[model samples]
Target: MHKIIVTGLTGFVGTNLKKYLSSYEIESLSVRYIPNQKIEINADAIIHLAGKAHDLKKVSRPNDYYEANFELTKQIFDSFLKSKATVFIFMSTVKAVADKVDGILTEDTVPNPKTHYGIAKQQAEEYVLGRKLPEGKRVYILRPCMIHGPENKGNLNLLYQLVAKGLPWPLAAFQNKRSFLSIENLCFLIKNLIENKMVVSGVYNCADDEVLSTNELVQIISLALKRKSRSIAVPKSIISTIAKIGDIIRFPLNSETIQKLTENYEVSNKKIKTALEIEKLPHTAQYGLERTIKSFINK
Candidate 1:
């Protein structure tokens, strides 16, 4: 049995990953963000999932990102380099590369992170990649896009609630394609990496096979809920003005939320898929979105 030590074991991705890796012997590590905190690294595989997620509320301190994402990763990775752990999986984000994707986001894209959260993770990625590795040990930095699953309420949930209440989606004029990562697909990729001895160790973009626009997502929610989804083609300029006002008034549909809802952030998963020697992921984008939408109904 492969013994794994998982940080952030209770998080959305971590919890789902643990359930997927139920056959393995898993140990959870709880590390405080205090200075010089100790990390125990005794396992065949070390999956680092804990980090300060991007605060959409914008209330977090700047140092909090460095301490939680960069410093903590440095400490744990230092221990991993010296320990018997054969594989190290770091859960990075595509935002570390770019906040807005012009076309498809690939591994070759130069990183220019605009947020402290992205900058800190980029720092951690640099720390891991800069180090000279031992002959047997492998390191993998996974850059996943927006990940959604059952029971986790993210922006998708907000859309679901709006659709459930029969509210028309007002931003149909915003035409954009965004990539998403399903938790099941993420676990599948991680498991393949852990079990396959020949897969190369490097940064890989993790995302679903298909890209969906927000307008299409509304339709999917409607299909799942058995409702006729209504979408309004509101003018983009008007929406932008409203979002700017929302930024000042702290409305739900602020500039950031608007960008999040309508941005073209498509990520390419070709690198990881090639490494796994697979043509398609286990779950399709529609299948995963439907599953997640249905879960909201039961809640």
Candidate 2:
């Protein structure tokens, strides 16, 4: 049996990946307690998904991100290299490339991580890349854009909440293209990377077939929830001023939140698609987002 070990199994992406690949002999285990090599010694492959994600609340320490995202990954990668595991997949983030991409983000972009979270993941990627790999054993550092799936509570949820309340989407004036990866497509790429030994070791950015603007996202959410999307073109200046105030009031509609929603974070999936020999992602970006919005709205 081809057994696979996945860390951070309880997270949104890990949980969804498990549900998607239920037929595979997969085990979700914690890496903090169990030593890395001890757990991975006998496994066929390891998917390093456990990490301290970016703290939106700004409550976590700087070392926390480095240790959890970078150090823990280093431990696992070292173990996988020594073990029988033929493949290792580390779930990184597109943020490792840049905080604000001037144009479309692809695998070729030089990394300039602005946040501690991005820097940590980038360091982890560098650690793996610097190593001399054993023959036939490959490492993949995957940088995926915002991932959405069942029970996910992030920007998608915020959008869902706005649309579900039948409130006017007042921030449609800031139209920008952003890329999103569905949990389904991510699992597909991971499965292929594990089963196929021919895949070369390096970083790959994953995303759905197309990019969508915030307005388009609202439209999709509205359609999915069977509600009318009432959008108002609130002046960007006024909205920005309100968002600035929101920062002091601890309102959810702060400048940072607004920028994240409106900013362009496009990533290219060309490398992944070429590797999989597929013309397009199996599931449409809106399909996954729509499903998730409806799932949480009904809940």
The ten-residue window of minimal lDDT in model 1 covers 31-40
- CA lDDT of 134 in candidate 1? 95
Give one clash count per candidate, in the order shown.
0, 0
Clashing pairs in 2: none
lDDT string, candidate 1, 104-221, tens digits: 9999999999999999999999999999999998899999998988887788977998899999999999999989988999999999999988998899999999999999999999
Please give, for residues 185-261, the per-residue lDDT of candidate 2 as tens digits: 89888877776667678899999989999999999988988888899999999998999999899787998889888
Name the weakest run of 10 consecutive residues (lDDT summed) in model 2. Answer: 33-42
lDDT value, residue 202 of candidate 2: 86
- Give the C-alpha miss distance for residue 10 in model 2, angstroms: 1.9
> Candidate 1, overall lDDT?
0.92
